[model samples]
Target: MIGSTSWVIPGTYYENALLLEGLVDFVELLVYTWDEDTKTLLFNEMDKLLQLDLSYTVHLPMDRLDNVIRAYNFFEEARFPVINYVLHPIKGWRRTLGEKVALENLKELIEPHNRMVFDVGHHFLGKKFPAHLKEAIVEIHAMGVIDGRDHLPLDRETAAFIKGFMGDLITENVLINFEVFDLEDLKNSLKVWSDTFVE
Candidate 1:
């Protein structure tokens, strides 16, 4: 089951509710810089939104370790087996946060519950991304350029770079999420993957 990291559309929880009721087998709840009150409300709502007994993956709040710890505690208390924990280096305003600090904080915060979802976008943004961080994270989600320009939708150059980096850096058992918007973009991404990996 292909799980999407982003489910929330800004100012539209009803739309999110409608989408969640459909045929999605798995989901990674992308919490935005976790607030205790917000997390509690969302967790309660998720129980109602999903039709089947759903499996959960969490995109942890990267800003504060407290938020991450709260999420871990919530998952443990709820007995939800988190498939992965998606990590981002920076918190807000695209501010540069060192990867060493990020990784160190993550290790201290995360328990032995699930895998890590390392975002390539953040890695590139962070000036101090470490080689050892790759070893630490379980899965990698490659966020292609999202400039909303039709002609430059995750263009070949970026895809090739990510492909080459993934080939070299990623170890076995790491899953990759190609974050794309719309059907046309998805098609373009698939073609790139096919051309790069097959024939």
Candidate 2:
């Protein structure tokens, strides 16, 4: 399934997600630091989301693994069925929180078959998507980030390569989130995906 990042929806996080009811299969909630006030707001909105019965996945903050664990627990206790907890293999965090280690750590919080969200662009940053992790991938953050500039539109050659490499995995159940910030870029990226990989 194809989805857009919640950041480009131009509203409160919950409001933006609500707007995606019929437009996409799921919403990857881009979560940041959960300050006390923000945490309250999030709990309230999460209740609304549960009531609405929208399919969702959470994109945890890249800066903190504790936040990721906490978010997962909150959603689990709330009885929300999150598809995946997407993660980034941040620099300097490799020793303590590598992708595999994080997945293992998450196993203590969740089931053995818990899924993960993978970012394709992160592969270029020395964060390789290992063969072992492929079985647990339920969603993907798709974008083109070159020379440290992220959220840039996917270029033609890169788009073609993606179609060649990732097109086969475009099943109806797996979510491909266009994790770009600009609205136009998101739309264009969707079109590129549709034209190139959705056949």
Candidate 3:
């Protein structure tokens, strides 16, 4: 099943509860940066949410490298089968550090997870795409664009990219997500995906 990250509400737990109520077969959790104090609060909140028994996939925080590292370790230790981990190429450091460094770091961070959600927008903005990173996971979800921007809707170019990427990966059932904002975009994206993939 396809789902979108719930970041519309103020608190994570509250938004999560709302998402559960929506009854989507799957949901994406964007667990952003958390300090020690915040982490404690978050854990307590998560415990309450877990009581609901709603299954979900987590999107690791991308604010800082340390945050990503810590989140990865937490999920690993908890043995949580993370559905996908989102990666953002370090801004200014991209040119200097290179995509290889980011790829290595991402591999180390998500070794425990079996899947990944690749944000085509970020990769496009960074102008650094690591083809090798595709080999590290069993499932790859290409996040599509919205309007003229990436990570929103399935535009022509992004659709082509998905087709090409899927061909190169040769992985069965590679998930593609259109990060749409409105109902129109969502409907259009579904049509675009159907037209492109369905016979």
- Per-model TM-score on C-alpha atoms: 0.60, 0.73, 0.59
Candidate 1 lDDT, 1-199, residue by residue in tens:
4333344344333244355434333456666676767676767765554444544566667578666666656766776566665555334412322221122123223222123355555544444234455455556554465442222235666667766765655544555444543435544655665566555
Candidate 3 lDDT, tens digit per residue, 1-199?
5454554345665454564444333455566774686466556666555555454566556687777667666766765545555554443323222121222133223222223345566555543445666655433344465554555656667777766775656444443434544434555666776677666
Q: How would the candidate models be sorted by lDDT, starting from the highest?
A: 2, 3, 1
Candidate models: Cα lDDT each = 0.50, 0.62, 0.51
lDDT (C-alpha) at residue 32 in model 3: 71
TM-score of 2: 0.73
**Regions more than 4 Å wrong, model 1:** 8-26, 48-55, 88-117, 131-135, 146-153, 168-172, 179-191
Q: Give the number of the best model, judged by lDDT.
A: 2
TM-score of 3: 0.59
lDDT winner between candidates 2 and 3: 2
Clash count (model 3, backbone only)? 4
List per-candidate RMSD values in Å.
7.2, 5.9, 6.7
The 10-residue segment of model 1 with minimum total lDDT is 96-105
Using TM-score as the yardstick, the better of models 1 and 3 is: 1
Which clashing pairs does model 2 show? none
